[model samples]
Target: MTAQHAAAGQLQLNYWAEARLQRWGHIAVPLSSTRVAIHGGYGRDGKKLRRLDDVVIVSSDGTVAPTVSSTPRPKARERHGAAAVEGGFVIHGGRAGGAFGDAWRWHDDVWRELRCEGSPPAPRWSHAFVALPGDACLVCGGRGDAGDLDDDAYVLDPATQTWSRVAAPAFPVAFACSTSDGQTIAFGGGRAARFADAAWSELALDDATAAASRRLAACVCATARPGELVVAGGVPADEGEVGGVAVLRIGEDVKCVAEAPLDVMRAYPVHAAAAFSGDGVVVFGGGVPCLSFAPVFGDSVRVVMT
Candidate 1:
Protein backbone atom coordinates (compact mmCIF):
# COMPACT_ATOMS: atom_id res chain seq x y z
CA MET A 1 0.00 0.00 0.00
CA THR A 2 1.16 3.50 -0.79
CA ALA A 3 0.65 6.21 1.82
CA GLN A 4 1.13 9.82 0.82
CA HIS A 5 0.21 13.19 2.25
CA ALA A 6 -0.49 16.21 0.10
CA ALA A 7 -0.86 19.87 0.93
CA ALA A 8 -4.57 19.82 0.31
CA GLY A 9 -7.02 19.09 3.13
CA GLN A 10 -7.68 15.50 1.99
CA LEU A 11 -5.52 12.61 3.12
CA GLN A 12 -4.55 9.94 0.58
CA LEU A 13 -4.94 6.45 2.01
CA ASN A 14 -4.61 3.33 -0.12
CA TYR A 15 -4.02 -0.36 0.64
CA TRP A 16 -1.86 -2.40 -1.75
CA ALA A 17 -0.66 -5.98 -2.06
CA GLU A 18 1.53 -5.76 1.04
CA ALA A 19 -1.48 -5.16 3.37
CA ARG A 20 -2.88 -8.48 2.06
CA LEU A 21 -6.48 -7.18 1.98
CA GLN A 22 -7.77 -9.67 -0.62
CA ARG A 23 -11.28 -8.29 -0.88
CA TRP A 24 -12.59 -4.97 0.29
CA GLY A 25 -14.90 -5.32 3.32
CA HIS A 26 -17.51 -3.26 5.15
CA ILE A 27 -16.29 0.07 6.55
CA ALA A 28 -17.28 2.18 9.55
CA VAL A 29 -16.92 5.97 9.40
CA PRO A 30 -16.13 7.30 12.85
CA LEU A 31 -16.99 10.81 14.01
CA SER A 32 -14.02 11.33 16.26
CA SER A 33 -11.60 12.12 13.43
CA THR A 34 -10.84 11.43 9.77
CA ARG A 35 -10.10 7.79 10.56
CA VAL A 36 -12.35 5.15 8.94
CA ALA A 37 -12.82 1.84 10.79
CA ILE A 38 -12.83 -1.29 8.59
CA HIS A 39 -13.86 -4.92 9.10
CA GLY A 40 -12.36 -7.60 6.83
CA GLY A 41 -14.12 -10.82 5.79
CA TYR A 42 -12.68 -14.18 4.75
CA GLY A 43 -13.98 -15.95 1.66
CA ARG A 44 -13.70 -19.59 0.44
CA ASP A 45 -10.06 -19.54 1.48
CA GLY A 46 -11.11 -20.74 4.95
CA LYS A 47 -9.41 -17.74 6.55
CA LYS A 48 -11.08 -16.20 9.59
CA LEU A 49 -12.55 -12.70 9.31
CA ARG A 50 -10.69 -9.93 11.07
CA ARG A 51 -12.22 -6.97 12.85
CA LEU A 52 -10.09 -3.83 13.08
CA ASP A 53 -11.66 -2.80 16.38
CA ASP A 54 -8.96 -0.41 17.48
CA VAL A 55 -9.60 2.98 16.02
CA VAL A 56 -7.41 3.96 13.06
CA ILE A 57 -7.27 7.71 13.44
CA VAL A 58 -6.33 9.60 10.26
CA SER A 59 -6.09 13.32 10.62
CA SER A 60 -6.39 16.29 8.26
CA ASP A 61 -2.64 16.66 8.55
CA GLY A 62 -2.31 13.49 6.44
CA THR A 63 -1.12 11.29 9.28
CA VAL A 64 -2.13 7.66 9.81
CA ALA A 65 -2.27 6.48 13.41
CA PRO A 66 -3.56 3.32 15.03
CA THR A 67 -4.86 2.62 18.52
CA VAL A 68 -4.25 -1.09 19.04
CA SER A 69 -5.12 -3.24 22.05
CA SER A 70 -5.21 -6.91 23.03
CA THR A 71 -8.91 -6.85 23.73
CA PRO A 72 -10.74 -9.95 22.54
CA ARG A 73 -13.92 -10.02 20.50
CA PRO A 74 -17.06 -8.84 22.25
CA LYS A 75 -19.10 -11.49 24.05
CA ALA A 76 -21.20 -11.96 20.90
CA ARG A 77 -21.10 -15.45 19.39
CA GLU A 78 -22.63 -14.76 15.98
CA ARG A 79 -20.68 -15.74 12.88
CA HIS A 80 -21.21 -12.89 10.38
CA GLY A 81 -22.24 -9.53 11.89
CA ALA A 82 -22.17 -5.71 11.83
CA ALA A 83 -21.55 -3.23 14.69
CA ALA A 84 -21.63 0.49 15.45
CA VAL A 85 -20.92 2.36 18.67
CA GLU A 86 -22.66 5.56 19.65
CA GLY A 87 -23.47 7.42 22.86
CA GLY A 88 -20.52 5.64 24.48
CA PHE A 89 -22.01 2.21 23.80
CA VAL A 90 -21.25 -0.32 21.09
CA ILE A 91 -24.37 -1.83 19.45
CA HIS A 92 -24.15 -5.10 17.54
CA GLY A 93 -26.46 -7.21 15.28
CA GLY A 94 -25.82 -10.84 14.45
CA ARG A 95 -27.08 -14.43 14.21
CA ALA A 96 -27.55 -16.72 17.17
CA GLY A 97 -28.80 -20.32 17.43
CA GLY A 98 -29.74 -20.38 13.75
CA ALA A 99 -31.70 -17.18 14.21
CA PHE A 100 -30.71 -13.55 13.69
CA GLY A 101 -32.32 -11.94 16.76
CA ASP A 102 -29.12 -11.17 18.61
CA ALA A 103 -28.44 -7.60 19.84
CA TRP A 104 -25.92 -6.51 22.44
CA ARG A 105 -24.26 -3.47 23.98
CA TRP A 106 -20.57 -3.27 24.79
CA HIS A 107 -19.17 -1.10 27.56
CA ASP A 108 -15.78 -1.24 29.24
CA ASP A 109 -14.91 -4.26 27.13
CA VAL A 110 -17.96 -6.28 28.29
CA TRP A 111 -21.13 -6.84 26.29
CA ARG A 112 -24.56 -6.94 27.95
CA GLU A 113 -27.81 -8.02 26.41
CA LEU A 114 -30.17 -5.14 25.69
CA ARG A 115 -33.79 -5.98 26.36
CA CYS A 116 -36.59 -3.63 25.48
CA GLU A 117 -40.40 -3.35 25.63
CA GLY A 118 -41.38 -3.89 21.98
CA SER A 119 -41.20 -6.65 19.42
CA PRO A 120 -37.79 -6.82 17.81
CA PRO A 121 -37.34 -6.84 14.05
CA ALA A 122 -37.61 -10.37 12.69
CA PRO A 123 -34.49 -12.51 12.62
CA ARG A 124 -32.19 -11.21 9.84
CA TRP A 125 -28.64 -11.08 8.54
CA SER A 126 -26.63 -8.52 6.52
CA HIS A 127 -28.92 -5.85 7.92
CA ALA A 128 -28.08 -2.13 7.54
CA PHE A 129 -28.19 0.05 10.67
CA VAL A 130 -27.46 3.76 11.29
CA ALA A 131 -27.70 5.87 14.46
CA LEU A 132 -29.26 9.29 14.29
CA PRO A 133 -27.85 12.28 16.14
CA GLY A 134 -30.48 11.85 18.78
CA ASP A 135 -30.87 8.78 21.00
CA ALA A 136 -32.44 6.72 18.20
CA CYS A 137 -30.93 4.02 15.99
CA LEU A 138 -32.70 3.03 12.77
CA VAL A 139 -32.50 -0.49 11.33
CA CYS A 140 -33.55 -0.91 7.73
CA GLY A 141 -34.29 -4.05 5.62
CA GLY A 142 -32.50 -7.39 5.71
CA ARG A 143 -32.77 -11.06 4.82
CA GLY A 144 -35.49 -12.77 6.83
CA ASP A 145 -36.52 -16.33 7.74
CA ALA A 146 -36.80 -19.13 5.15
CA GLY A 147 -34.48 -17.36 2.72
CA ASP A 148 -36.97 -14.54 2.30
CA LEU A 149 -36.36 -10.80 2.14
CA ASP A 150 -37.73 -8.30 4.71
CA ASP A 151 -38.58 -4.61 4.35
CA ASP A 152 -39.59 -4.03 7.97
CA ALA A 153 -38.14 -1.03 9.80
CA TYR A 154 -37.42 -0.59 13.53
CA VAL A 155 -35.88 1.98 15.85
CA LEU A 156 -33.85 1.48 19.04
CA ASP A 157 -33.33 3.94 21.85
CA PRO A 158 -30.34 3.54 24.12
CA ALA A 159 -31.97 5.38 27.04
CA THR A 160 -34.79 2.85 27.55
CA GLN A 161 -33.35 -0.09 25.60
CA THR A 162 -36.62 -0.15 23.67
CA TRP A 163 -37.60 -0.57 20.02
CA SER A 164 -40.37 1.23 18.14
CA ARG A 165 -41.79 0.61 14.68
CA VAL A 166 -41.22 3.08 11.87
CA ALA A 167 -43.99 3.13 9.32
CA ALA A 168 -42.95 2.16 5.82
CA PRO A 169 -43.14 4.68 3.03
CA ALA A 170 -46.24 4.72 0.79
CA PHE A 171 -44.28 2.44 -1.53
CA PRO A 172 -42.72 -0.83 -0.49
CA VAL A 173 -39.05 -0.68 0.67
CA ALA A 174 -36.72 -3.66 0.81
CA PHE A 175 -33.11 -4.76 0.30
CA ALA A 176 -32.48 -1.34 1.75
CA CYS A 177 -28.80 -0.63 1.28
CA SER A 178 -28.46 2.59 3.25
CA THR A 179 -26.31 5.28 4.95
CA SER A 180 -26.65 8.42 7.07
CA ASP A 181 -26.85 11.85 5.39
CA GLY A 182 -25.68 13.45 8.66
CA GLN A 183 -29.18 14.83 9.36
CA THR A 184 -31.26 11.84 8.24
CA ILE A 185 -30.88 8.47 6.49
CA ALA A 186 -31.41 7.41 2.84
CA PHE A 187 -32.10 3.87 1.54
CA GLY A 188 -32.82 2.22 -1.81
CA GLY A 189 -33.68 -1.21 -3.27
CA GLY A 190 -37.09 -2.93 -3.47
CA ARG A 191 -40.14 -4.22 -1.63
CA ALA A 192 -40.50 -7.43 0.40
CA ALA A 193 -42.08 -9.47 -2.37
CA ARG A 194 -39.61 -11.89 -3.86
CA PHE A 195 -38.17 -10.58 -7.19
CA ALA A 196 -39.93 -7.21 -6.80
CA ASP A 197 -37.96 -3.97 -7.37
CA ALA A 198 -38.85 -0.35 -6.63
CA ALA A 199 -37.51 3.19 -6.18
CA TRP A 200 -35.40 4.70 -3.39
CA SER A 201 -36.56 6.62 -0.34
CA GLU A 202 -34.91 9.38 1.68
CA LEU A 203 -36.18 8.91 5.25
CA ALA A 204 -35.64 12.31 6.88
CA LEU A 205 -35.79 12.70 10.66
CA ASP A 206 -37.44 16.16 10.64
CA ASP A 207 -40.86 15.06 9.42
CA ALA A 208 -41.85 11.41 9.77
CA THR A 209 -44.57 11.68 7.13
CA ALA A 210 -42.59 13.62 4.54
CA ALA A 211 -40.33 10.97 3.02
CA ALA A 212 -38.84 11.91 -0.37
CA SER A 213 -38.75 9.48 -3.30
CA ARG A 214 -36.56 8.20 -6.17
CA ARG A 215 -36.98 5.92 -9.17
CA LEU A 216 -36.49 2.18 -9.81
CA ALA A 217 -33.09 1.00 -8.59
CA ALA A 218 -32.38 -2.23 -6.73
CA CYS A 219 -29.56 -0.70 -4.72
CA VAL A 220 -27.63 -3.25 -2.71
CA CYS A 221 -25.05 -0.65 -1.58
CA ALA A 222 -25.17 3.14 -1.18
CA THR A 223 -23.10 5.86 0.50
CA ALA A 224 -24.17 9.30 1.64
CA ARG A 225 -22.25 12.52 1.27
CA PRO A 226 -23.22 15.96 2.50
CA GLY A 227 -25.80 16.43 -0.27
CA GLU A 228 -26.06 13.20 -2.28
CA LEU A 229 -26.57 9.46 -1.96
CA VAL A 230 -24.45 7.40 -4.40
CA VAL A 231 -26.12 4.01 -4.90
CA ALA A 232 -24.16 1.09 -6.22
CA GLY A 233 -25.14 -1.89 -8.40
CA GLY A 234 -27.48 -4.83 -7.75
CA VAL A 235 -29.63 -7.20 -9.79
CA PRO A 236 -32.73 -5.83 -11.45
CA ALA A 237 -35.80 -8.04 -11.83
CA ASP A 238 -35.65 -8.14 -15.62
CA GLU A 239 -31.95 -7.44 -16.10
CA GLY A 240 -31.21 -10.35 -13.74
CA GLU A 241 -28.01 -8.49 -12.79
CA VAL A 242 -27.14 -4.82 -13.12
CA GLY A 243 -24.00 -2.90 -14.09
CA GLY A 244 -25.60 0.49 -13.47
CA VAL A 245 -25.07 3.12 -10.72
CA ALA A 246 -27.33 5.98 -9.72
CA VAL A 247 -27.38 9.04 -7.47
CA LEU A 248 -30.14 10.71 -5.43
CA ARG A 249 -29.88 14.28 -4.31
CA ILE A 250 -30.92 14.77 -0.68
CA GLY A 251 -34.27 16.39 -1.55
CA GLU A 252 -34.17 16.34 -5.33
CA ASP A 253 -34.62 13.73 -8.06
CA VAL A 254 -32.80 10.45 -8.50
CA LYS A 255 -30.63 10.38 -11.63
CA CYS A 256 -28.50 7.77 -13.35
CA VAL A 257 -25.31 9.62 -14.18
CA ALA A 258 -22.48 7.07 -14.16
CA GLU A 259 -22.28 3.40 -15.09
CA ALA A 260 -19.51 0.99 -14.08
CA PRO A 261 -19.95 -2.71 -14.71
CA LEU A 262 -18.94 -5.01 -11.90
CA ASP A 263 -15.80 -7.10 -12.41
CA VAL A 264 -18.11 -10.03 -11.70
CA MET A 265 -21.90 -10.11 -12.07
CA ARG A 266 -23.52 -11.23 -8.80
CA ALA A 267 -27.00 -10.90 -7.36
CA TYR A 268 -26.89 -9.70 -3.74
CA PRO A 269 -29.08 -11.14 -1.03
CA VAL A 270 -30.66 -8.82 1.49
CA HIS A 271 -27.88 -9.75 3.91
CA ALA A 272 -25.10 -7.84 2.15
CA ALA A 273 -23.51 -5.04 4.19
CA ALA A 274 -22.06 -1.67 3.04
CA ALA A 275 -20.48 1.47 4.50
CA PHE A 276 -18.86 4.77 3.46
CA SER A 277 -15.11 5.18 3.77
CA GLY A 278 -12.35 7.30 2.21
CA ASP A 279 -13.95 8.80 -0.89
CA GLY A 280 -16.35 5.96 -1.78
CA VAL A 281 -18.64 3.21 -0.47
CA VAL A 282 -17.33 -0.22 0.59
CA VAL A 283 -19.53 -3.33 0.23
CA PHE A 284 -19.19 -6.64 2.03
CA GLY A 285 -19.87 -10.31 1.29
CA GLY A 286 -23.46 -11.64 0.90
CA GLY A 287 -25.45 -14.30 -0.95
CA VAL A 288 -27.90 -14.23 -3.85
CA PRO A 289 -31.61 -14.96 -3.53
CA CYS A 290 -31.73 -18.24 -5.56
CA LEU A 291 -28.18 -19.34 -4.71
CA SER A 292 -27.30 -18.71 -8.35
CA PHE A 293 -23.66 -18.10 -7.50
CA ALA A 294 -21.64 -19.67 -4.72
CA PRO A 295 -21.91 -17.78 -1.41
CA VAL A 296 -19.59 -14.75 -1.47
CA PHE A 297 -17.21 -13.60 1.24
CA GLY A 298 -14.39 -11.07 1.44
CA ASP A 299 -16.19 -9.06 -1.25
CA SER A 300 -15.88 -5.26 -1.25
CA VAL A 301 -15.13 -2.18 -3.37
CA ARG A 302 -14.91 1.61 -3.22
CA VAL A 303 -17.39 3.44 -5.48
CA VAL A 304 -16.21 6.98 -6.01
CA MET A 305 -18.85 9.46 -7.12
CA THR A 306 -18.01 12.10 -9.69
Candidate 2:
Protein backbone atom coordinates (compact mmCIF):
# COMPACT_ATOMS: atom_id res chain seq x y z
CA MET A 1 0.00 0.00 0.00
CA THR A 2 2.98 2.35 -0.19
CA ALA A 3 3.11 5.09 -2.88
CA GLN A 4 5.57 7.63 -4.19
CA HIS A 5 4.42 11.24 -4.12
CA ALA A 6 3.71 12.40 -7.70
CA ALA A 7 4.03 15.82 -9.25
CA ALA A 8 0.90 17.99 -8.86
CA GLY A 9 -0.33 17.62 -12.46
CA GLN A 10 0.93 14.08 -13.20
CA LEU A 11 -0.85 10.90 -12.07
CA GLN A 12 1.14 7.84 -11.08
CA LEU A 13 0.25 4.17 -10.98
CA ASN A 14 1.14 3.18 -7.44
CA TYR A 15 1.33 -0.38 -6.29
CA TRP A 16 -1.49 -0.97 -3.86
CA ALA A 17 -1.27 -4.66 -2.99
CA GLU A 18 -0.63 -8.17 -4.16
CA ALA A 19 -4.03 -9.81 -4.52
CA ARG A 20 -4.67 -13.35 -3.20
CA LEU A 21 -5.18 -14.91 -6.62
CA GLN A 22 -3.23 -14.12 -9.77
CA ARG A 23 -6.37 -13.94 -11.88
CA TRP A 24 -7.59 -11.93 -14.86
CA GLY A 25 -10.88 -10.89 -16.46
CA HIS A 26 -12.52 -10.19 -13.10
CA ILE A 27 -15.09 -7.54 -12.17
CA ALA A 28 -14.15 -4.89 -9.63
CA VAL A 29 -16.89 -2.82 -7.97
CA PRO A 30 -16.26 0.03 -5.60
CA LEU A 31 -18.34 -0.68 -2.51
CA SER A 32 -17.47 2.65 -0.93
CA SER A 33 -14.66 5.14 -0.66
CA THR A 34 -12.62 2.72 1.45
CA ARG A 35 -13.66 -0.65 0.09
CA VAL A 36 -13.64 -2.65 -3.20
CA ALA A 37 -15.25 -6.00 -3.92
CA ILE A 38 -13.64 -8.45 -6.37
CA HIS A 39 -15.61 -11.08 -8.21
CA GLY A 40 -14.88 -13.97 -10.63
CA GLY A 41 -11.94 -14.28 -13.06
CA TYR A 42 -9.83 -16.78 -14.93
CA GLY A 43 -6.75 -18.38 -13.45
CA ARG A 44 -4.23 -20.67 -15.03
CA ASP A 45 -4.12 -24.35 -14.06
CA GLY A 46 -1.22 -26.00 -15.82
CA LYS A 47 -2.06 -25.41 -19.50
CA LYS A 48 -5.77 -24.96 -18.87
CA LEU A 49 -7.92 -22.08 -17.59
CA ARG A 50 -9.78 -22.31 -14.32
CA ARG A 51 -12.74 -20.06 -13.47
CA LEU A 52 -12.27 -18.51 -10.05
CA ASP A 53 -15.17 -18.56 -7.59
CA ASP A 54 -13.86 -16.46 -4.77
CA VAL A 55 -15.33 -13.13 -3.64
CA VAL A 56 -12.93 -10.96 -1.73
CA ILE A 57 -12.94 -7.54 -0.11
CA VAL A 58 -9.99 -5.17 -0.25
CA SER A 59 -9.45 -2.25 2.08
CA SER A 60 -7.62 0.97 1.41
CA ASP A 61 -4.76 -0.41 3.55
CA GLY A 62 -4.33 -3.38 1.16
CA THR A 63 -5.78 -6.10 3.39
CA VAL A 64 -7.69 -8.91 1.69
CA ALA A 65 -10.48 -11.16 3.01
CA PRO A 66 -12.73 -13.73 1.39
CA THR A 67 -16.52 -13.29 1.38
CA VAL A 68 -19.45 -15.56 0.69
CA SER A 69 -23.20 -15.22 0.18
CA SER A 70 -25.88 -16.87 2.28
CA THR A 71 -27.95 -17.20 -0.88
CA PRO A 72 -26.93 -18.85 -4.10
CA ARG A 73 -24.31 -17.17 -6.24
CA PRO A 74 -23.98 -16.75 -9.97
CA LYS A 75 -22.11 -19.49 -11.74
CA ALA A 76 -18.37 -18.78 -11.72
CA ARG A 77 -17.46 -16.65 -14.75
CA GLU A 78 -14.91 -14.29 -16.26
CA ARG A 79 -14.74 -11.57 -18.96
CA HIS A 80 -18.16 -10.38 -17.72
CA GLY A 81 -19.41 -6.77 -17.89
CA ALA A 82 -20.58 -5.09 -14.69
CA ALA A 83 -21.96 -1.68 -13.76
CA ALA A 84 -21.94 -0.41 -10.16
CA VAL A 85 -24.85 1.94 -9.59
CA GLU A 86 -26.42 3.55 -6.53
CA GLY A 87 -28.69 0.68 -5.54
CA GLY A 88 -26.78 -2.37 -6.70
CA PHE A 89 -24.12 -3.79 -9.02
CA VAL A 90 -25.36 -5.20 -12.33
CA ILE A 91 -23.42 -7.86 -14.29
CA HIS A 92 -24.09 -9.43 -17.64
CA GLY A 93 -22.59 -11.52 -20.47
CA GLY A 94 -19.43 -13.59 -19.97
CA ARG A 95 -18.25 -17.09 -20.71
CA ALA A 96 -17.61 -20.13 -18.59
CA GLY A 97 -17.21 -22.85 -21.32
CA GLY A 98 -19.91 -21.01 -23.27
CA ALA A 99 -21.20 -17.43 -23.37
CA PHE A 100 -23.86 -16.24 -20.90
CA GLY A 101 -26.66 -13.71 -21.41
CA ASP A 102 -27.82 -13.81 -17.79
CA ALA A 103 -28.25 -10.50 -15.94
CA TRP A 104 -27.57 -10.54 -12.22
CA ARG A 105 -27.63 -7.83 -9.61
CA TRP A 106 -25.82 -7.78 -6.30
CA HIS A 107 -27.95 -6.46 -3.48
CA ASP A 108 -28.77 -7.28 0.15
CA ASP A 109 -25.55 -9.30 0.27
CA VAL A 110 -26.65 -11.82 -2.33
CA TRP A 111 -26.31 -12.51 -6.04
CA ARG A 112 -29.81 -12.42 -7.52
CA GLU A 113 -30.20 -13.13 -11.21
CA LEU A 114 -32.64 -10.84 -12.96
CA ARG A 115 -35.48 -12.22 -15.02
CA CYS A 116 -35.72 -9.66 -17.75
CA GLU A 117 -38.75 -8.97 -19.92
CA GLY A 118 -38.55 -9.33 -23.70
CA SER A 119 -35.60 -11.23 -25.14
CA PRO A 120 -32.06 -10.62 -23.92
CA PRO A 121 -29.04 -9.99 -26.09
CA ALA A 122 -27.34 -12.99 -27.59
CA PRO A 123 -25.01 -14.80 -25.23
CA ARG A 124 -21.61 -13.29 -25.90
CA TRP A 125 -18.30 -12.45 -24.32
CA SER A 126 -15.55 -9.82 -24.86
CA HIS A 127 -18.20 -7.13 -25.39
CA ALA A 128 -18.91 -3.80 -23.73
CA PHE A 129 -21.59 -3.52 -21.05
CA VAL A 130 -21.70 -0.12 -19.39
CA ALA A 131 -23.93 1.81 -16.97
CA LEU A 132 -25.54 4.85 -18.53
CA PRO A 133 -27.30 8.09 -17.44
CA GLY A 134 -30.18 6.50 -15.59
CA ASP A 135 -30.19 3.18 -13.78
CA ALA A 136 -30.42 1.61 -17.24
CA CYS A 137 -27.32 0.18 -18.97
CA LEU A 138 -25.98 -0.30 -22.50
CA VAL A 139 -24.68 -3.56 -24.04
CA CYS A 140 -23.01 -3.78 -27.41
CA GLY A 141 -20.72 -5.77 -29.72
CA GLY A 142 -18.95 -8.85 -28.47
CA ARG A 143 -18.03 -12.24 -29.88
CA GLY A 144 -21.38 -13.96 -30.43
CA ASP A 145 -22.24 -17.52 -31.48
CA ALA A 146 -21.90 -16.97 -35.20
CA GLY A 147 -18.80 -14.84 -34.53
CA ASP A 148 -18.00 -11.14 -34.02
CA LEU A 149 -21.31 -9.26 -34.01
CA ASP A 150 -22.05 -6.14 -36.01
CA ASP A 151 -22.79 -2.77 -34.45
CA ASP A 152 -26.05 -3.41 -32.59
CA ALA A 153 -26.24 -1.89 -29.13
CA TYR A 154 -28.86 -2.99 -26.63
CA VAL A 155 -30.15 -0.86 -23.80
CA LEU A 156 -31.50 -2.43 -20.63
CA ASP A 157 -34.25 -0.23 -19.22
CA PRO A 158 -34.62 -1.30 -15.60
CA ALA A 159 -37.98 0.47 -15.50
CA THR A 160 -39.40 -2.15 -17.85
CA GLN A 161 -36.63 -4.76 -17.52
CA THR A 162 -36.75 -5.04 -21.27
CA TRP A 163 -34.01 -4.60 -23.86
CA SER A 164 -34.34 -2.50 -26.99
CA ARG A 165 -31.75 -2.37 -29.76
CA VAL A 166 -30.16 1.02 -30.44
CA ALA A 167 -28.90 1.68 -33.96
CA ALA A 168 -26.35 4.36 -33.14
CA PRO A 169 -23.10 3.81 -35.05
CA ALA A 170 -21.32 5.50 -32.21
CA PHE A 171 -22.39 2.62 -30.11
CA PRO A 172 -20.63 -0.78 -30.19
CA VAL A 173 -17.72 1.52 -31.01
CA ALA A 174 -18.42 3.79 -28.07
CA PHE A 175 -19.44 0.71 -26.23
CA ALA A 176 -15.77 -0.32 -26.13
CA CYS A 177 -15.36 2.11 -23.27
CA SER A 178 -17.96 4.59 -21.97
CA THR A 179 -16.80 7.07 -19.31
CA SER A 180 -19.51 9.12 -17.64
CA ASP A 181 -20.14 11.46 -14.76
CA GLY A 182 -23.68 10.11 -14.45
CA GLN A 183 -24.87 13.01 -16.66
CA THR A 184 -23.11 12.42 -20.02
CA ILE A 185 -20.76 9.84 -21.58
CA ALA A 186 -17.51 9.96 -23.58
CA PHE A 187 -16.70 7.19 -26.03
CA GLY A 188 -14.38 5.68 -28.76
CA GLY A 189 -10.69 4.79 -28.30
CA GLY A 190 -7.32 3.88 -29.89
CA ARG A 191 -5.09 6.26 -32.01
CA ALA A 192 -7.24 9.21 -30.95
CA ALA A 193 -9.84 8.42 -28.35
CA ARG A 194 -12.72 10.63 -29.58
CA PHE A 195 -15.44 12.16 -27.51
CA ALA A 196 -18.62 11.48 -29.46
CA ASP A 197 -22.30 11.49 -28.61
CA ALA A 198 -24.24 9.64 -31.33
CA ALA A 199 -22.05 9.84 -34.42
CA TRP A 200 -19.09 7.64 -35.35
CA SER A 201 -15.89 8.79 -37.01
CA GLU A 202 -12.50 7.08 -37.09
CA LEU A 203 -9.46 8.94 -35.77
CA ALA A 204 -6.06 7.78 -36.92
CA LEU A 205 -3.72 7.52 -33.95
CA ASP A 206 -0.15 7.61 -35.21
CA ASP A 207 1.56 7.43 -31.85
CA ALA A 208 2.17 3.81 -31.09
CA THR A 209 2.30 4.28 -27.32
CA ALA A 210 -0.74 6.55 -27.11
CA ALA A 211 -2.78 4.39 -29.45
CA ALA A 212 -2.23 1.30 -27.31
CA SER A 213 -3.30 2.85 -24.00
CA ARG A 214 -6.67 1.15 -23.59
CA ARG A 215 -7.66 -1.04 -26.44
CA LEU A 216 -10.27 -3.87 -26.33
CA ALA A 217 -11.23 -4.75 -22.69
CA ALA A 218 -9.04 -2.09 -21.12
CA CYS A 219 -10.26 -0.84 -17.74
CA VAL A 220 -11.67 2.73 -17.70
CA CYS A 221 -13.10 5.04 -15.02
CA ALA A 222 -14.16 8.68 -15.02
CA THR A 223 -12.14 10.61 -12.48
CA ALA A 224 -13.59 12.84 -9.75
CA ARG A 225 -13.15 15.73 -12.13
CA PRO A 226 -15.55 15.90 -15.02
CA GLY A 227 -14.14 14.95 -18.50
CA GLU A 228 -10.95 13.32 -17.22
CA LEU A 229 -10.28 9.56 -17.50
CA VAL A 230 -7.63 7.06 -16.38
CA VAL A 231 -6.84 4.22 -18.82
CA ALA A 232 -4.92 1.07 -18.00
CA GLY A 233 -3.53 -2.25 -19.38
CA GLY A 234 -5.01 -3.98 -22.45
CA VAL A 235 -3.94 -5.38 -25.80
CA PRO A 236 -2.73 -2.38 -27.78
CA ALA A 237 -3.44 -2.01 -31.48
CA ASP A 238 0.23 -2.36 -32.38
CA GLU A 239 0.41 -5.10 -29.75
CA GLY A 240 3.89 -3.82 -29.14
CA GLU A 241 3.93 -3.99 -25.34
CA VAL A 242 1.71 -5.28 -22.56
CA GLY A 243 1.65 -2.73 -19.73
CA GLY A 244 1.11 0.96 -19.06
CA VAL A 245 -1.29 3.44 -17.38
CA ALA A 246 -2.17 6.72 -19.07
CA VAL A 247 -4.56 9.63 -18.63
CA LEU A 248 -6.97 10.80 -21.34
CA ARG A 249 -8.67 14.17 -21.08
CA ILE A 250 -11.37 15.02 -23.62
CA GLY A 251 -9.45 17.75 -25.42
CA GLU A 252 -5.86 17.03 -24.41
CA ASP A 253 -3.19 14.66 -25.68
CA VAL A 254 -2.88 11.30 -23.92
CA LYS A 255 -0.44 11.46 -20.99
CA CYS A 256 1.48 8.51 -19.62
CA VAL A 257 1.38 8.66 -15.82
CA ALA A 258 4.88 7.52 -15.01
CA GLU A 259 8.30 7.63 -16.63
CA ALA A 260 8.35 3.83 -16.62
CA PRO A 261 4.91 2.35 -17.43
CA LEU A 262 5.58 -1.12 -16.05
CA ASP A 263 7.91 -0.09 -13.25
CA VAL A 264 5.10 -0.07 -10.69
CA MET A 265 2.23 -1.32 -12.86
CA ARG A 266 0.93 -4.77 -13.77
CA ALA A 267 1.42 -6.19 -17.25
CA TYR A 268 -1.07 -7.29 -19.91
CA PRO A 269 -4.17 -6.81 -17.84
CA VAL A 270 -6.49 -6.86 -20.81
CA HIS A 271 -9.76 -7.48 -18.99
CA ALA A 272 -8.76 -6.00 -15.68
CA ALA A 273 -11.42 -4.31 -13.57
CA ALA A 274 -11.35 -0.66 -12.46
CA ALA A 275 -13.44 1.55 -10.18
CA PHE A 276 -13.20 5.22 -9.25
CA SER A 277 -13.14 5.41 -5.49
CA GLY A 278 -11.99 8.19 -3.24
CA ASP A 279 -9.41 10.28 -5.09
CA GLY A 280 -7.96 7.55 -7.31
CA VAL A 281 -8.85 4.63 -9.57
CA VAL A 282 -8.18 1.10 -8.27
CA VAL A 283 -7.14 -1.57 -10.83
CA PHE A 284 -7.54 -5.20 -9.96
CA GLY A 285 -6.22 -8.53 -11.32
CA GLY A 286 -5.31 -8.91 -15.03
CA GLY A 287 -3.30 -11.40 -17.08
CA VAL A 288 -2.11 -12.70 -20.48
CA PRO A 289 1.53 -12.44 -19.51
CA CYS A 290 2.16 -14.30 -22.77
CA LEU A 291 -0.24 -15.46 -25.48
CA SER A 292 1.08 -18.98 -25.42
CA PHE A 293 -0.13 -22.47 -24.63
CA ALA A 294 0.87 -21.98 -20.99
CA PRO A 295 -0.08 -18.41 -20.20
CA VAL A 296 0.71 -16.65 -16.95
CA PHE A 297 -2.04 -15.30 -14.65
CA GLY A 298 -1.97 -12.14 -12.51
CA ASP A 299 -2.75 -11.12 -8.96
CA SER A 300 -2.17 -7.38 -9.17
CA VAL A 301 -3.98 -4.63 -7.24
CA ARG A 302 -2.88 -1.10 -8.04
CA VAL A 303 -4.28 2.47 -8.14
CA VAL A 304 -3.65 5.67 -10.14
CA MET A 305 -5.15 9.13 -10.72
CA THR A 306 -4.54 12.47 -12.46
lDDT of 1 by residue, 169-200 (tens): 34344333333544344443321111112223
Q: Clashing residue pairs in candidate 2, if any?
A: 22-298, 191-205
C-alpha TM-scores of all predictions: 0.59, 0.80
Question: What is the C-alpha local distance difference test score of candidate 2?
Answer: 0.63
lDDT of each: 0.41, 0.63
Clashes (backbone N, CA, C under 3 Å), per candidate, total 2, 2
Pairs that collide, model 1: 126-271, 174-190
The C-alpha RMSD of each candidate to the native structure, in angstroms, is 8.3, 4.1
Q: Which ten residues in a row have the lowest lDDT in candidate 2?
A: 251-260
**After superposing candidate 2, which stretches have Cα over 4 Å from the reference?**
1-9, 44-49, 170-180, 183-210, 251-260, 264-267, 289-295, 299-301
The C-alpha stretches of model 1 lying farther than 4 A from their native spots are: 1-33, 39-92, 106-112, 146-151, 170-172, 177-224, 242-245, 265-272, 284-300
Number of the top-ranking candidate, with lDDT as the measure: 2
